[model samples]
Target: MIEFKLPETRYALNSDVSVAYQVTGDGPIDLIVVPGFISHIEFQHELPGYTAFLRRLASFARVVTFDKRGQGMSDRMSGAPTLEERMDDVRAVMDTIGSERAALIGFSEGGCMSILFAATYPDRVSHLILTGCFSRSADRLSEEAWEARLEQILRLWGTGELTKSIAPSEAVDPAVIAQYAKWERLASSPGALRTLLRLNRQIDVTAILPTLQVPTLVLHSKADLQVPVALGRKLAAAIAGVRYIEYPIGDHAVWTSNNETVPGDIEEFVTGRRDHGLLEFERVLTTVLFTDIIDSTRNATAMGDERWVRLLGEHDQIAREMVSKHRGNLVKSTGDGVLATFDGPGRAVRCALAFGSAAKQIGLSVRAGLHTGEIEMRGSDVGGVAVHAAARVMSHCGSDEVLVSRVVTDLVAGAGLKFAERGSHELKGLPGKWDLFAASG
Candidate 1:
């Protein structure tokens, strides 16, 4: 289902240090991604929706993202990088890519750097965009309290504890937490992060905001935990001709969830136009389906990385077809499988069975689970109790079998679909015991 190809990574030399960067797409506009606190340019694609998000941006412009110096693929340093050094790295990357002028999409800590870059090189920046970014490090925190906050980062540096605050829903899944933990370890070590924190404490771009010469846009989620929306509002208020947009949902990693409109918003801002049809985001009752390839890790190991990746592509192709055949929205792919939503329970149940059969034909086994409940739609991503319930139901499934919650069976009562009682069981992470059933023809 992913259409964009991964860009080849290359290094830009800033004197002796090598800064790793990638370029994707061939549109007229060149867009640079200023990554946030934690980043592993290579491992980032492994995260859910990240690659797709980049591809979406690629559709409009040539996208460029690099590991900030001392983070990800960039050369590891003994000390934290200063704003001047980071800016030099950016210019070096721009020169290597032959990009004369480009829009900068700065996220989190990257926002501070972007602000500095835009102010320093007015001739080279086409537009300025900041999301989930803060202009000041203190963020209204008192000196004592701010120090405590910085210390807490040290305490949980490599534990993936940040996921709990930035992505609460995904944090519940052990696999997601483990992935984030590994990313933390790869991005920077505890000692290096400590050094960075000491330097970050002094960051304050408020004084330079009004002097920015390029067009700017500021976006924030009212509920962003990592960078409060208040800081975002303050940043926008200081800019002379800036546009600010706030969403009802909050997640620091807006590209991953909730703010599905983010890409479209960026598109409109940069291009002066946008796709009229954005995914409808609203709360509604629907049948949510979850499918997982059985023993995916083991299978990946046995098949080897390259072959396994090809197989996943095949699986995704079939899954997408089946969802469309059943008139369901394929919300997103879950690495080995997919999460989808359907208007009717019967079609979702049938699609699961059909997709399962198709998987076996390719020498793969898949288990599916379905539940009908109220789901909160955040653009293209779906979340809420119903979504989690469906994943839990799938976890209880056997190889190649299709399972459904009692709610699903009840909804499809007279649709001619038969379900065998699987009895009551506790769905992990959800309160209370619930009856589960196996769907059959």
Candidate 2:
């Protein structure tokens, strides 16, 4: 395993607050990365491809990353930072680094701030790059829709739901989702994030788009869920002579999936050289596991809303822990169940069995199913025939039974696990009959 050495953290005073910053590499060109709504410089490095993504850029530039005021290692703030305050934070970091001018890589909400900063202080910015950015938050959704969205986000803030929603492919692995959940919690409190999102809707930079004098590059994904591809197009259209590249596929984040592509593109855009080849997408073979709570609706109805909500929270927490413990990825909690993936079919079955045992301690009856196949990564989510097959196997499961498909059984043969014939069953929406089995230690 390649060890990643985290850049030494330094403090840059952003007014009364100390904005935490880290610098990597020492190339001629200086680059400042503007973070989105949530950022934790330390926690972010834990994610796969993120460090490599930075390393790719660092190969040609001096890269600086920081946690904005009120987030991550930076001092907390009582309220969201306005664009002016954000600009001040940037200036503070630059001043600390003794950088006269630098290129800017803005992501999501940070893109809005970067645009304003570049336009306001053109002399200070060498180049402007926006990734998965939108021109106006309000333009993306109606007021009612935005409110509902904010509510939904806050409701699931620390539960790693963002990965499922924004990056489904990553959600297929429980480890990624679990780490992301920790990152989310460390990035900001639920209340702080709520404040930030509320003010985000008020951001309107469309009027300033044409007036920008700095050279700009707009990189967006065609299938980004958070900031729609259409909005990204409109954002690019408003800018003057902006070099825009809408990738054929990706989600909100650029650090994973086809991560190296962006850095190579940035290298070319800023330095007039393309030195890296395209990295083929990461289709992987793994076991998909599905766990469902037996009679979940009945349990919820009998428990009532308040009690059921608390109980569900416990169940979800336990589910996440078990998935992580067994080296599985918890994709998302299905209200009464969870979808996860494991590299080994045996581990997948063992996780389900362990989870089932855990759930019973809390008076919950859970069943699980497993199948092994080649799965495609859709953003952070995983899908393919294997996922559906696993779900179908679980649907046919008896109460407290860990069921699996023949694919799973075949993969784990002679691995010290045993299974009983569950009979031939026709899975809905899938062609052909499937032979199922009841899995046991």
Question: Which candidate leads in TM-score?
Answer: 1
Worst 10 residues of 2 by lDDT: 275-284
TM-score of 2: 0.64
Q: For residues 141-191, what per-residue lDDT tens digits would candidate 2 score against the true structure?
A: 888898898899999888888897567667877777888899999999999
Off by over 4 Å in 1: 1-4, 276-441
The 10-residue segment with the lowest total lDDT in model 1: 275-284
lDDT of each: 0.87, 0.87
Per-candidate TM-scores read 0.66, 0.64
In angstroms, how far off is 430's CA in candidate 2?
Answer: 52
